[model samples]
Target chain A: MWDYSETVKEHFYNPKNAGAVAEANAVGDVGSISCGDALRLTLKVDADTEIILDAGFQTFGCGSAIASSSALTEMVKGKTLDQALEISNQDIADFLDGLPPEKMHCSVMGREALQAAVADYRGEEWVDDHEEGALVCKCFAIDDVMIRDTIKANNLTTVEEVTNYTKAGGGCSSCHEGIENILAEELAARGETFTPGAVGKKEGFVNLAEKEAAPAKLTGVKRILKIQEILEGLRPALQADGGDVELMDVEGKNIYVKLVGACSGCQMAAMTLGGVQQKMIEELGEFVKVIPESERPVEIAGA
Target chain B: MADIYLDNNATTMCDPEVVAAVQPYFSEQFGNPSSLHNFGNKVGFAIKKARKSIQTILGAEHDSEIIFTSCGSESDSTAILSALKAQPERKEIITTVVEHPAVLTLCEFLETEGYTVHYLKVDNKGRLDLDEYASLLTDQVAVVSVMWANNETGTIFPVEQMAEMADAKGVMFHTDAVQAVGKIPMNLADSKIHMLSLSGHKLHAPKGVGVLYLRRGVRFRPLLRGGHQERGRRAGTENTIGIVGLGKACDLALEHMEYENTEVAKLRDRLQEGILAAVPHSFVTGDPDNRLPNTCNIAFEYIEGEAILLLMNKQGIAASSGSACTSGSLEPSHVMKAMGIPYTAAHGTVRFSLSRYTTPEEIERVIEAVPPIVEQLRKLSPYWGDGGPIENPEEAFAPVYA
Candidate 1:
């Protein structure tokens, strides 16, 4: 069970404004039932004063979601539209004592609704930035822009933290790689380097830890198998470059490969070697050194 | 308010008699079963008696067939691994999509181990296609592990017929009967199922004790290799007190199996009917006619299940949800997903599992408590309007990006 605060429990049980504001001038609805959470915020605001006279919400989610929406309503009341815009999801969570890290998306939903509501009141075109980005998480319908935004705003270095903030990469986690890519890009843009091994911090439901673990510790047959798996995926790309690579032999951390076809004696063979070898090190292990088959002496003949 | 626990499927309250039977073994009778002394001999005899009792409950022809393990997961692992070891040539494993993590996770790991794992999908009602299953039985299939009943929806699988087919094909069959054993009648001696797994806690017994019934004359391999415990099948000293409690619990289950089917089932139906009648956009999940007598899985549209469960928790009512939020799994229950339950309903699925200990008054209390909880959550739901749930619920319930 989630260790919800007493204030959250109180707000969920006795929400200050649980109904829609019928005389509301503007409304904002964010999230949906499919994502396991949704919120609709309706506000009654004075046009001239640009102040929110009253705020009410309808939330479909967990305890924290209801409490977050309820708390959002309470915080926005009597505040000007400009002032309400400043009310961050953190401020709403603060009002409810605090929300669990996993339920932080609930607070983020509240903030989105408030932003949407203010845009609706100003008579401005509400263009969602998320639509511009490619879809990343199909299960939750989360986009790259939303994930990147969450990572930037929170200074999140981990994919799990991004999931907590945006609900991306939470379901099925087929999009974890997508989430990780987005995280890496955002973290890189912020001049922060991502720890590859740390990407697998989230365990249990999905066993991505083994996939994300550094393959540098692998030895012998296991290391060969790992290299073969990575090569299989990279083979097509290599072939598209009028080049192909074969696993000639593996001795210790040194991987000897034979470049075939146009790649065998091409002038750019050194460049290709450097490029493919870099990829191999990144995926397989940092300890791995890729070398041409001709450069290595014949060890154990066929081996 | 008095607490009403209907999440027996997650875990059940230990039977007082079973607890009483185990209390003495914990202190006064505490001895290593492997020790060469009178006290240890007594402990060994107790374990033997427990094994016999479980064997009787399962209707196994021989007591030696029952191998005690730490938990249901271990038993499941042992059986599946044993099958693969026995038939090293066969690279394929057939299982259902809605198996418990014990079986499902293992099968997923097997896929990475260069094994072809075929996950048989279930229909919208959570029933496996027997014809599809029949066609999958080939010479290359090493083992077929299907659960006797689903955990989330309580839908019973046709494991008997599936087992028969697998046996005919020279393939080994294993059933993770963790959720089916105590609630339903079983006669393993009559079935061709090579191995069956059951957890002790599911049948009012204590946790940390489980039984894996491996039929006699079946090719077997041990997952754990150590001291000659569990007839060299599983290693480690027997869980003496836990095993004794399990034995007593099985005795009680055998005595009250009729009551569970009749009285407990009635209460389950009452709870199901009450919600279906009182709550709008609510419907029962899984096959109605073919399910565990003590389980009722209902989905209330327009609202998420974690919210419903939280509100119910405030009222001192306990239940389990298939919602992504409740499980922290990000995806709703696989059983619901396999059944093709839409996002609107799947996120709101709640499971109410009862036991023979459930009373009519507690059922009535739960019935009264649930409707208001649903109403409160619906009031908070954007998809719920004054009339009821919104039209085109699928689209309305989907997450809107901004």
Candidate 2:
């Protein structure tokens, strides 16, 4: 068990304010069933004078989610719309005696609800209200407009932060550079001159840690191979669960497979890895090794 | 609220009698074991008494054989790494993939540094393939470290058989009996095993104390170098209180071994039976028979182990899981992986390690509370929804929605 303090557990169990305010000025709902953790956060903001009112939330997550919701509710209970808007994911995480590093996303759920509530209070809607599109990151329900706006609003600093905040880059990090392109485009559209070298220059010099992190880069590097033949045999097992694995890379001996759609998060990835992937890969020869990245990658635009 | 705790494998509440034994070490006999005075001699005498207490319980023939260390992991590290160091010309080490990380990681590091590591694989039920292990044996292999019982699966490998294999090959053999020592009856003289590691915390003893049994005349090197302590083997000021507690705990374990082997094993089986019956898509992780009397690992599908463990914590039932969700690593257990446990089961695998202190009442509450919590999570599972096919009838057997 992660050491959740007594105070935090008490708050999670007996949250100070939990129910939604009746017909509240701004109702912010941040999680969804599709998402592992979601927050249905409603804010009661003053309309006539545009002042402070009330806040409450319902969260579906581990202690971090409930605690973050309780902490955020306690934070913006009487604060003005703008002040409540300023409460960030980091602030809420810090307030709850801290969350584990990976669950930092729970605090982000709280922050998203706060943002959505603030936007609703301001009588605003998502920029691309209705649009035609393929699911960019089906796992997170993130789309092109949200990804663009996240970059535009947050000045998205890195590809990782995008995944961290928006849950978009997590799925197929394939869209990483594409999102970066959109980020640069949006910056340019705002007339902020886009300097191509700015990306590397700001983090300009190489640090020792970066040098030490070289092994993963070396290991992750893919070598060219006959992808068609590998997929041909691997498709049978993939089709069993209404899912499929595509060979992303073939680096010498190691084969990297991407789990698509439902299969991405399926509990049987080991069966996928060993029962299916390994069996087929090993059938080819003892030399062929499989490195399956089975975790789902949702579209997460880091701000 | 009265919360349930089953995570005994992590660490356990110190035994009351052992606590009473250790209390004096911290206060009345607080002098350093290394101090060169009468007061220190009293502390030294206390340690000597504690060692003798353990020696009596272990049925060890000699006092010098019991080398005290900080913890079971430390003893495992010292024994395995020391064997490698002593037999420098031997560049290969053979061990099961299921050995604890203390020995496993050291072997991995050794493998990276030009030493060959042959990880003998286990079957789906977590049994080591002795033939496979035997095939890997070579004259140049320096050491072999196989755990007496796996911490996660509770599967009992044929340690005596494997140890004899190592002995026949003239390779130094070690067993991390951290979880097994007090739970199982271990006769050091009977087995041909060269080295054995035991943990105190597993048997309700204090945490920072453990034992390393190096059979007489085994080639070894000291992992610690300092002022003479542990007969110049592991050098440091002894954790007097912990050792005393461990010594007392060992005595207790020795006294209760038969009772535990029977009654406690019944309680563990009761838990396993209730969970498998009440919870759908759930099954035990290790071999049903031929295992430790105290451990039961059950996996509840479509749920995370940490979440299950957390809910169990809320109800005051403590158990652990090999679920990757428990730690920063999103990937589930490598032990489960080596055993070919499917990821769905791996994500949901929770280990309930029993002790002499574990009661039938605790098992009853776990049986009542665990099924509902699992049902709550499964109800929300997308696969159980209307759009999904009910491949198994249990998926359709809904626990009347609240």
Candidate 3:
């Protein structure tokens, strides 16, 4: 189903360096069977030259994983340990022409295995275990540090892209918020604004265009329900701030809300209303104004 | 050499007879069945015949009970949602965890909409716990939707008995019979299932056509509402070509049912036995004695499924896998996971579904092709060592972070 390149197919069908290097002194293992993909890279390194004389791999995963492992083995041979360490996941993907975005994690596995193997040869402590970083995706055992690093390396802007590259947020998707936070932080570090729903345009999986095109045309009851749902989502945030909002009425693009609890007449009520309006527009994919119940026109207010 | 397709559970090649039967409706009988003219009447009559064919296959009392829809998903959605609407007071639903996404996803959405859903679990053999099913049926339960057979494992559920249980509780019972319809025999007239869904494509008909068999007296609400089509039970113009194709597929299926159980099953057993004999550490992954004759799911320890599938693809063999890699998910199939299959075997699960058209020679090809692929992948698997699959595989392959 994945649109794998012919080169990838070729590498998978006739994997160049499968199995372990017979007289290998350095070895590295990344991923696990439970993760759905694992790779063990064995390298025969020349002690004097610090060069990899031979490289071989055994992978337990998909076609792309096998192909990536084969490609990684071929790419590392005859290269210095430093040079082999320079091969990024993208480089492995490039060697195979390209891997589907969903299978990009396969290349990442290859890169990690290479790094582990190099570290093993150098006798440096390599940590592929989960103890080093804060775990973000409990389902896939992906961590925040790994997510941030992957985002930086791959220029990933969306949670879906991060998942493709790192297998985070791909399981139950409960960690998408964590991944988004990490993405936002990385993007902010790069001086880029994190745009929500941008994944809809890039992946085209969600129909943001349809929602954005006709949010105003949603029928009365449906629009009311949508607004109520959005308000419910915002309720916890408002309540956390010792304030609350109630939907008073919805007329056209105007949303009438009553700021209750500690927010009724606060100095930041205007800012709060502005924030609420912004969230509504983002979530509803429509332009709308949030009006305080006190500001409601006399005629409609009485009615 | 031609490609040998063993992925019938995913989809099937359209039979020649089905294609021929569908051809005329695309051109000569292109008139809308709703129009008031001879052309419309001819198409309408053809649709009636198609409905009757489905009725006969399902052994339903009336042809009107067969409501044609777009696909199996639509039929499933219609039945579940309609049951809820008809019994608005009942806010509970009971279903199995191993249902196709068509049912599972809908039930999940319903959960968010304030409906209490009890997901029944399956055993290691993929068999439902009847005692649990019996206990889950309560007065507040609106519907119990369970699949007749699992798509991944082809493990047939005792739906008739389950339906009888639900029916006694005044609850609607629906079965997604998409996989079970053509391969297994069922007489709905003697059953208590209020609704059943079957996709045309699964039975060798064209896609975009399915049937929702609503028993004569079951209360109903339409999922799609517009034109007074499908006698107001369903909306939109009829899929005439697809309906005719489905009708013919049903006729052909009725004729080949015996062969599917006997000859096709023989090929399936041969393939299963051959692959198991050839490949060590491989085992079947379903209720062996109670599965569809056309389906066999095997798991090769220490190797991943996509690798095996790709290697098989090189040899012009087609199959399906429950591997997380193949599913585009990070976890193996929910079916395998629910069955508590060890990760060592779950990641390597492959499903080979045959049809009545399958031959022993093709089965022989698969048998010969699969062993080497498994052997090849196992050799590449880190868990597979010099002797064979490593002992303590579960501890070696357990979730590292967990």
Q: Per-prediction DockQ scores?
A: 0.29, 0.04, 0.29
Residue B197 CA error for candidate 1 (Å)?
Answer: 1.0
Interface RMSD of 2: 10.0
Listed per model in order, the count of residue pairs whose N, CA or C atoms clash below 3 Å is 0, 31, 0
In the predicted model 1, the residue pairs found to clash are none
Ranking by DockQ: 3, 1, 2
A147-228 per-residue lDDT for model 2 (tens digits): 7767778765455445545766554355555556666678778878544444432111122123233332222322233344
Of 2 and 3, the candidate ranking higher by DockQ: 3
**Residue range B145-226, candidate 3, lDDT tens digits:** 9999999999999999999989988889999999999899889999999999999999899999999999999999999889
**Local lDDT at A240 for model 2:** 76
Report the C-alpha displacement of residue A43, candidate 2, in angstroms.
20
Question: Which regions in candidate 3 have their CA more than 4 angstroms from the true location?
Answer: A129-303, B394-402
Q: After superposition, how far is residue A70 of candidate 2 from its true place, in Å?
A: 13
